[model samples]
Target: MHESKLIIAGGSGFLGQVLARYFKTLGWEVIVFTRSPQANRVAREVQWHGETVSQWTRELEGATAIVNLCGRTVDCRYTTKNREEIMDSRMKPTRTLGEAIARCKNPPSVWLNASTATIYRHTHGPAWNESGEIGATPEAKDEFSVEVARAWEETFNTTATAHTRKVALRTAMVLGDGPNSVFPVLLRLARLGLGGRMGSGRQFVSWIHEADFCRAIEHVIARAEFSGPVNIAAPNPLTNAEMMHLFRGLVGMPFGLPASEWMLEVGAFFLRTETELIIKSRRVVPGRLLASGFQFQFERMPDALRELRMRMTGDVKCTLPLPAI
Candidate 1:
């Protein structure tokens, strides 16, 4: 008898792809929901329109959990149009999935949704907990990091299911391989002698490894005790400069010139990306995940980057101190 599997919405994304594969390796079947046309893969495919729930609701039959990673990338610049798309993209699938779970004859016991860490204020030197001061829009910036982050969480929390355990993952940047990889891209730039800190290099970057990220999801799914907002990030936090140094070390390049806040703003304006992502400091901690007994395989940033580099390029390099947490 095979162990039952879980359902993953947006399972084709970078993070979702890693997670779907991870769960498969653990001998659990995976049902992926996406708006894209069917692509051949290891997991079962369920067609979704992103506007209304489909008959794919049957996929939840006898499933172990449902992890919803569906949301527009917050990395993009926030224009009025982008804002609508972001909100709708996030809320639509959320409402659809929640409604589907609510209507399922046998819904998965766990429902984990994607959220953001920018939801917390990042006023350098200040620390935020699950209870500490949540973010208010910083007066200096026009970007809607706090607003979008708040609305994203609000949409998830209000849309509920009485039968299913809903877990919202207030996650930070998830670094890994293939597309959306922060390593090879940054390392490639580093190898090209372009690697350096963005903006002031003082902003805090909270992250989770690809391997451990999968485990954390599984931990939440199987634990049966964890619910509500959980911060999925590394215990060992680092600054933008620290991250740049690690990357430069990995790719054998001296850390190059740092991009000032103004430069990032100008560049992001052209690229339609958000500068607050790299400009505003976010010293976020994983207070809930740690206390919940979720052990991370690579809690430290340097180690995680090294392992990821090894996996991608098959190159062995200098070692890093593993995080005890």
Candidate 2:
């Protein structure tokens, strides 16, 4: 009998590596379709440009699951070229995977595509859930990012895949143990006494721990009832000020320097990133997951931060070894 297999497209980054290891521990044959072929002991690596359907598509046949985490990082300035690349990087691969899955004689049981919590409008009122309104309002200052997310989900949903269950993962900021990830950056800022509220500081910040994020994906795959866009975030969403305060407390920083809108603009400019990422209010909630009996290990912000802090400080025993790539 053939072994169970999982295909993670663009599984070379921080999240992907952790996911690859998680599935590998379950004794599944893990195949990663990435552009660059790197030496990895745990998973098999296949080379494919994300936009094209190549021989890598063969791996999709009879696969147990396929999680599409493809897309360029939105950690840069939103220049015209950057915007185009950002949109294209997500849309093309999603459509291409759909086509590949359509061609598969034995398609995977589920295809979990990555979306963002930022798809919802910037607001402080109600927490945006799976059924929440998508942000296309002219009032939204960062409508461009929301539009990109809208198009990304649309391409995945519209694709013809009869045999496969499709779920758009509307993910929030994932707090993971990686130097390049947002956690480390925020940790550095906290240590430097720069972990302060940006803009009005009333903006909401939603996030999930890396462990819960992986587990949630697995839960979705197992439960046939979960479909459509599911918000992959913690239940307890907090204001930017509250979040920064918690971070400062965890890192032993008594105070953080608050930044106004103009100050944030200058800082973003210096960092070569956009301020909207930090300033935009994203009060996202995982209503569907809770309704579907998905239990998160890290439900609250303080608990999640504590675990991450311990991991970063080498106080807790590491569960999974860091990926070779």
Which number leads on lDDT? Answer: 2
For every model shown, the clashing-pair count is 1, 0
TM-score of each: 0.93, 0.94
Taking the tens digit of each residue's C-alpha lDDT, what string does model 1 give over 81-185?
888887888888888888888888888888888887777777566556566467664632634767766777787888768888888787877888868756667
For candidate 2, write residues 1-325 as lDDT tens digits.
Answer: 8777889998888888888999888788999988897985457899889777888889899998999999998989999999999999999999999999999999999999999999988888998888787775444468889989989999999999999999999999999986547888887898898988878989889999999999998899889998898999999888888888877877778789999888988988999998878888889999999998889898887778888878768766423221111
Which residue segments of model 1 deviate by more than 4 Å?
A: 139-143, 319-325
Model 1: ten consecutive residues of lowest lDDT: 316-325
Query: Could you give the C-alpha RMSD of every candidate to the true structure, in order shown?
Result: 2.4, 4.9
Compute the lDDT of residue 92 as modeled in candidate 2: 93
| Model 1 clashing-pair count | 1
Candidate 2 error regions (>4 Å): 136-140, 316-325
For candidate 1, the TM-score is 0.93
